[model samples]
Target: MSILLVEDEAPKRKNIRSLLEQMDLLGLVSEACSVGSAIRSLRSSSFDLILLDMSLPTFDIVAGESGGRAQGFGGVEVLRYMDRFKLPTAVIVVTAYPAFSQGDKEIDLTELGKNLEAQHPKIFRGIVFYNSMFSTWRDELKTKIEEVIIR
Candidate 1:
């Protein structure tokens, strides 16, 4: 499967990429560190799944400066960009947002799952994959790929 992983953290990004490599599933995994880069990559190629981060720091340079905005947001903007720009790609919110109140030293994947379901019910093909801090990328992902490809 062609997987596009969009993340901004070094550790989490490396961990997930390593996991994919270990699982022999990094064949078509494209890495993007921000929403803009991911959007550009999406415009150039097609991917089967998009592993998105819920918190992204996007920028818009207007002049010689190399900065725009450093907001603590992610997937919501990415989705909004996709819809506004008419980019056709499936996304999976693999975030650690609902895992806590945004970095409070606590975790709650269950609540995250419920919120994902409620907000993304129409996106049935999307997977609310666990946060980057939460390890374990199983061969079950391969199974899911098979099911999706077959359909």
Candidate 2:
């Protein structure tokens, strides 16, 4: 199955890739580090699954330049784009943050997941909180992937 991984942090991306490799499910895996790059990939290719991070830079980071402003709900934007285009790809948010700002208030991951599912039910599969210190996220991700595969 084709998979698109959208994450800005190098270490996290590496870890996720390693996990996918371990699962032996790394078929046609594409990586994108920013909102723009992720969107471009979505436009050009079709993916069975997308492992997304909640926050991302506006564009890909250059060697000497900082990537543009970071979007707190970047994964949401990507989901919206997929919904707009009626893409059949499913998304599982792999976020490091437990909560993020939404306007003036903070929204927890659970609430964000519910909102996303409500807004884009067709493509929003679920959310997986990632913490490098714990192995739970790895198991959770594996379960989610297995579910997708069975579907």
Candidate 3:
């Protein structure tokens, strides 16, 4: 299956790509490092699944520059874009953050997951909490990917 991985951090993105390669599920994998790049990719190609990072920069950072504003709900914005265009791609949010601020209110990952599933049921598959120090996230991600593959 074709997959789009949207992650701003190079290390995390490399880890995810390595995991997918190890799992032998790296079919037509594409990478996007920011909200703008992700959206541009979405507009240009069709993906069977999207592994998204919740927090992301508004645009990609150049090699020698780093002044772009970050968006706490960048993945959510991608989902909104999918919903708006009625894209049928399944999404699995992979984030390192435990909580995020929505306007003035801070919501935990659980609430955010529930809200995302409820609001974008058509494309939202699940959320996986990722920590480089832990292996549980890898297992959870494997399970989620298998579930999506089965469906």
- TM-score for each of the candidates: 0.66, 0.97, 0.95
Ranking by lDDT: 3, 2, 1
Query: Model 1 over residues 1-151: C-alpha lDDT tens digits?
Result: 7888887777777876776787577887987766677777778888777777766666433358453465455566676666676665666666545555556555465665566557554442444454554434334344544555666
Would you list the C-alpha lDDT of every candidate in the order shown? 0.64, 0.91, 0.92
What is the clash count of model 3?
A: 0
Write down the RMSD of all candidates, one decimal each.
4.9, 0.9, 1.3
Q: Is candidate 1 or candidate 2 better by TM-score?
A: 2
User: For model 3, how does the per-residue alpha-carbon lDDT over 35-90 read when each residue is reduced to its tens digit?
Assistant: 88999999999999999999999889987867288888888889999999999999
Model 2: per-residue lDDT, tens digit, 1-151?
9999999999899989989999997766999999999999999998999999989998999898688988998888888889889998989999999999978999998999899889998888899999999989999999998898889
Candidate 1 residue spans exceeding 4 A from truth: 60-67, 99-151
Candidate 1, position 44, lDDT: 87
How does residue 145 of candidate 1 score in lDDT?
A: 49
| Predicted structure 2: lDDT | 0.91
Pick by lDDT: 1 or 3, better one:
3
Q: Model 3, which residues run further than 4 Å from truth? A: none
| Span of 10 residues, lowest total lDDT, candidate 2 | 19-28
